[model samples]
Target: MLKYGVTHRLSTTYHPQTSGQVEVSNRGLKRILERTVGENRASWSDKLDDALWAFRTAFKTPIGCTPYKLVYGKACHLPIELEHKAYWALKHCNYDLKTAGDHRKVQLNELNELRDQAYENSLIYKEKTKRLHDSKIKNSVFNIGDRVLLFNSRLKIFSGKLKTCWTGPFTIAQVFPYGIVELSSTNGPNFKVNGHRLKQYFGGDIPPMVVPDLQTFPMDQ
Candidate 1:
């Protein structure tokens, strides 16, 4: 990948949304396998190829075309369609060996253009999705000296159910761009954490509830 000028990005911990596309694809594949395997759950491995073929040939909203079409510069022919004499199949059936070979070569030559178009469509779709997501997200505004509770995300193994996951009422020491916050706690050293982990702490003493004394009077017959 380094030789081909491809850059690798690492997804942050506890944030699967960063790799949303992969997660979505995995979910789709899982659903397909669930439907195909039926009662024989262990035989899902046998249907993996069929599921993959369905996934590849199915139209993707992001790219506005099937993955197979983007790569091959033409739509994939299903077994049923080919058997039932699809237009493309019938056309190719009439063509001689040389003619069919030439047509395939033509499609291969146009594959790059098809891939470029798909890439552009994917970028546009991503931009639209980002805009929609951003519109719904309320931006967090923090300042120095503000009290905030830090979310305890590291405790994943057999944690107590009654214990609160949020750890500290740490004072914000510094607020930086792109949701980076520096926090200082009374019992711990100062540390930088993502702003998303912190929520404003409004700690104060609760007023005690008072109960009035009750007097009972005796009733005469």
Candidate 2:
């Protein structure tokens, strides 16, 4: 339907159920917001925004910079004075910026230097982040004739048809190193499919690999 102007596929489940922790956190956060924000459901949305604000400002591993700082070069100030002081130490003081105003060119130059440095640091930070984050996935690649689970997040039921966000531990007929493999059903004929839509099936209980690294390199002798 590309000619008919279709843009994207709507799904009840798009992202794989790789991490149960994220789902559990969402559930717990719901209970927390509900109990504390009693009878104010509409206002509950603000709690999520606040939670995101807090989370993005918190220290991130590997990169050594928060998502907030990586994005905007600073963190938000909490209402508590000590938290403000802490943030000043973490961000503003590092650059030696006294205030938005009340600054001379020397301080301005220093702040500008820090600001530019932070941006440069962010690139290194982002790469390190990706390296650490992607290290596990890079180890999870499969070869030809491997088994996999294809995701069927296609909203395939109205009432009693079916409801499985995933399908198969199907056999791999062909493997493409770019994280794409040709999948085939075990007990049926309809198996040839794209590998990008599939995941490594680590049985039913264990979660599929989140990020699979398929970068191949020449052997060292």
Candidate 3:
């Protein structure tokens, strides 16, 4: 990528299945593609450039600059402006070589400041998003020896609605960071599951559960 002056960045693994910004970008692109091609979805590939141009030039309030400007360090000249000369375009067209060179240098010098301002705006945007997300999250707190319910969606296909949707009254064997807990079932296997899926078991007499034999579930799942 460095050969062509491109930078490649991997997505954060914090919660890869639910990446907010990427999903938003994909949704916006899909909307653009739908509007550009209408019912002729097969022609979307042909109109890809037009769709990209629209996205690049569109003002994004989060950073207060078009994507095109951020990448090229200057505002984009639309096709119409180039062909039929807007007022600003007309004025620029009359500039001498030295004047244009000086203007270009000045713009390049200002690019750093523009990028810094955009970076600050992005940090603020992320903090607001984090707060909004955290506000909706009711964190599940579990302690060792406490009984809790385990969500049984995987077993539901065979059992149907008549059967229990939750399987546990399982004892908490261990607690981990990021809302994960180790569970043990009486005379059965021990496993780890997300705290979101487990609720405190408050119904009846708790059974003695053992966890010497561990059955680890996929962390990504």
**Highest TM-score scorer:** 1
Each prediction's whole-model lDDT (CA): 0.83, 0.59, 0.78
For candidate 2, give the lDDT.
Answer: 0.59
TM-score to native of every candidate shown: 0.68, 0.38, 0.63
When 1 and 2 are scored with TM-score, the better candidate is: 1
Give the worst 10-residue stretch by lDDT in candidate 1. Answer: 9-18
TM-score-best of 1 and 3: 1
User: Which residue window of length 10 is worst by lDDT in model 3?
Assistant: 9-18
Model 1 regions lying over 4 Å from their true place: 1-11, 40-43, 92-94, 143-145, 150-177, 180-194, 204-221
Q: Distance (Å) between predicted and true CA of 132, model 2?
A: 8.9
Record all residue pairs in model 3 with backbone atoms less than 3 Å apart, i.e. clashing. none
The local lDDT score (0 to 100) that residue 128 gets in candidate 1 is 86
- Which pairs in model 2 have colliding backbones? 137-213
Alpha-carbon error at 207 in model 3, in Å? 12
Per-residue C-alpha lDDT of model 2 across residues 1-221, encoded as one tens digit per residue: 78989865322234443333365457656766776565767888768876666566767543466666556545545557455567455554334455554544445456555556666765675676557756755345667777777766555446355656676678877765434455667577644444456677766576676988789999999
lDDT per residue as tens, model 3, 44-107: 8998888888988998877789888887778877768978879887766646888878888898
Best of the two (1, 3) by lDDT: 1
Q: Which candidate is the best by lDDT?
A: 1
